[model samples]
Target: MKNKQEIPAVIVADAKVFDYLKEKVGERKTRTEAYSDLLDKSLAGFISPFLRKQDYDLQPCQCHVTISDLATEWHWHRATVRSFLETLEAFGQLKRTRLAKSIVITMPVQSGQSSATFVIQRQPDFAIQLQEVLSDWIVGKTTSADVGNLCGQVVHQAMTGMTGYESRHCPDSHIDTASAHAGKQEEEIRKTALGCIAHAALQRVLWKSRFDDSSPLIEFFRHDLDEEWVSFIEASKELAELILDTEACETTFDTDDDKERLKSLRKPFLSLLARTQEPAD
Candidate 1:
């Protein structure tokens, strides 16, 4: 058995591959268990010749295949095959290079031509969490609200415009416009506000559950807050900490106190309401 400190060849080959797996399967398993389970499933092609035959066809001359060709030949969904190919690339098992022309199809001809082909080099021992999340969203088990929350989090990291006091880049145009139109006929803005409040509350509860106590909101504040919301950004961290600490108190509040607390929270968010309520300026 290898020591836990020892680096596995699989991980060394592609660190991104392991990150992909951890993001999908989660951080619960022991290192050995993660290695064995991911490696065993990913390397099944080498262990089972029949399974390999079922999934891929070996050709003496052919070095590259289109994603669609592999999907049709193996009787697998195109998206599934593409996902596996991505995993292989991530793990350093495969190097995918985009090809311009259509390759010969061993299976029955599909109506459409494939846009690109990939060179299958080495199969990776990891998978993609984004694809998994998308699959879950498609299956109806995950709600639109969950999808929105996850997208918001990812966008928060990758892009600056979507989060914090300077949320001009957040993708709220369509929703905001629809909300405005709905406001004329009914209380759409109120409903939207309620939903945002509920989501914020849920996030607070989840944070408390994980930390056993409230986390300092300053820890999650966006670094770009200062750049965009210049005036408010200076004090945003202090304000956020105050809000979080106030919200974290154990005792339930009466209606008056609840209203007052909400009024306080709304004050900060309202400073940017003009920007958020209007179309991206």
Candidate 2:
């Protein structure tokens, strides 16, 4: 078996010259270009508009999308869309939040902290998080958009020393009705930066005890975070620390009861968890 430290790192290429060359060469997309394009679309949420009903599960063009919608938009087979997403997800280059009918693609853009990798692992999906607030639209359907910094670069690097920031160029968002909206973007991230940092502390505590059989904290990492799960995590901090924390949880009546308590916590969120179909390892 390989040492845990032997894990390989994933590269996040800047969206620049490489794609320009690809476009000049041909219209057909390689898997590399497809992932690039998908990322680009999500980043370009300024124009994507919130055309659907006000379901808390949906984010505005501020970078939320359905798989069927994206496949049609890209003119690719749905299988093709799923394949690219699954591949990217496994590499940790992108994140996919699977909903009842469509998958919410996060992480085409990551910038200042409001959130981790987009807000927690090197997973940078906060691009939309900023836009949602900047544009004042119902953003990223994250159940706990309040926990915007749950998985952020500040949180990730502080927790694991990984460079979780994804610095892509922002689209033409003119809140001042001008060119770039950099000022406002930075402003809002500051507001949420503290929350992101606090969550990082929580993440660090969770990571230290991930292997403890009696602890279920690792469930956050094992499963893709949905809106419901996020809210559940934030809803009761002291309760979570007592029940989910490794040291705290181990002080149970017994292992069986410990598991039962863990199950109780999971039951509320399993609706989305059970329905989720992440790309296989």
Candidate 3:
């Protein structure tokens, strides 16, 4: 038997087969394990080293073609192509449709093979179109601003469009009024904006919290700002009191504590602005 390293090296050199293997087995595993699994499944044996003429016998000429035609054109096995088609459909890129057969194939003698025709439909590439539309929107509105402002604009556009759709097509008459749509849209926008602001605020705090001799709470804040900020502030307060207890001199404002306090205060400032802003403007 060939050495384990030699087998995987041979398989990995073929770009097409290597990519397929990598997709099946993630990047974290050893190459030997991936090759062993492929060999065990008989996939390695079935893979053709060179294209065969029969592979293109029933290929389609159009850009929009059936799964069977794609399989033939790409020289992929029928079952593998079927699996790929199913995955694409799940991702909303393809649609499948059925057609009634106008003619049937009859075998001369008792044969095991049976044949049927299926019609395949391809969805309009909405995912790519949506990405392009969003890119254009952002490009037109691009400006130098803080992260919070950028995130706010993106969220506003997405929520407004989604709310417009909800208003037009909502089936429940009781919940379909203009006021209800506006209220729900505002609530959603507020939640999303607040979440973004919180993230930005926490990021600023984390960046400042890092020093030559940082506390564990400060380190934790850097790693997990959302969950650790409250605890960090509480611990900072406790530390402030400890300093106060030890010092007998007159109270003098500490710059570090003042900065930490200001960092904690930015969230409420953004929240107030968000609450006061009108949706129409």
Candidate 4:
């Protein structure tokens, strides 16, 4: 086993990198949570070269990483850490092989596409939880879109509670234009905050399809954040560009009348779920 102590001390590639993570992850995550997430990304980058050598035509972009080493470095439970890795694999973010006690992780991307990076929100940590939920929903072999629809419902359920205020105000139509026509500032503020959170969650789900870092919706990571959190942020131009280039797909599912508003997000939810089942080639 590699010496856990020898795992290079966490170093900031760019002090400003953290700011981007914070922005992407949202205020829903604590600085500690955000820092830990950034550290993982940093460690993954450090481990990438080693992983590249293990890449195979059948299992490309592979690397050997021990659960103990990760748990020790991250000060997390071994089981929890293992669960997270398994969840990543389950989500098709990576593939894992157990070589004795050591874990070999493979990125299922093409050699030329190795530059691709994936982001997922670690705080709400919904990926793994949602993966498990979908497992039950996926009774038999199903399409990625089907699983995605189920995942979308889960997201819709999560954001549903936040919309209570909006429902009380509009009752019939929660659309911003409807509320805007009525012109109520309190309702608008509530709706905007809720919208931001819902949108962030939806965006995170969509990004998951592309296999990049995914974060929950909260607030945009500000470039001018305190130096303490500076290492968390990364430039968002690429992510922003990706979002612009990608179009959202909508799906429909049966729901109570109250949840009719969530139908529009079916495409995004399905998109996230579908990405996980994408061809491994």
Tell me the tens digit of each residue's lDDT in model 4 across 1-281: 95544311112133245455554343234434534453444335434333446643333345566677666655666665665565455443456767655666664332333111211211123333454444433433545575556555545543443244345545455476534533343343234333433433453455445543222211223322233243223213223323444333121223444133233333443454446544221
lDDT scores in order: 0.36, 0.44, 0.36, 0.42
Model 3 lDDT per residue over 117-189, tens place: 1001111222222222233233334232533344554555544555565556555664546456556656644
Best-fitting candidate, measured by lDDT? 2
Output candidate 1 Cα RMSD. Answer: 23.6
Give per-model TM-scores: 0.21, 0.34, 0.28, 0.28
lDDT for position 55 in model 4: 45
Model 2 CA deviation exceeding 4 Å by range:
1-12, 24-27, 46-51, 57-62, 114-281
Candidate 4 or 1, higher lDDT? 4
How many pairs in model 2 have backbone atoms within 3 A of each other, for residues 3 or more apart or on separate chains, i.e. clashes? 21
lDDT of 1 at 164: 29
Error of 4 at 234 (Å): 48
Worst 10 residues of 1 by lDDT: 115-124
Report backbone clashes per prediction: 4, 21, 0, 26
Best by TM-score: 2
Q: Write the per-residue lDDT of candidate 1 for residues 1-281, one digit (tens) a residue.
A: 94655321211234344455553334334333334333433333222322333334433222345656555544556655555554334423334444453222121111133211111111122122223333345445667697656544432332221112123322576556533433332232223223444443443333333423222222223442333556346445434444467565334344665445443543434333222222111
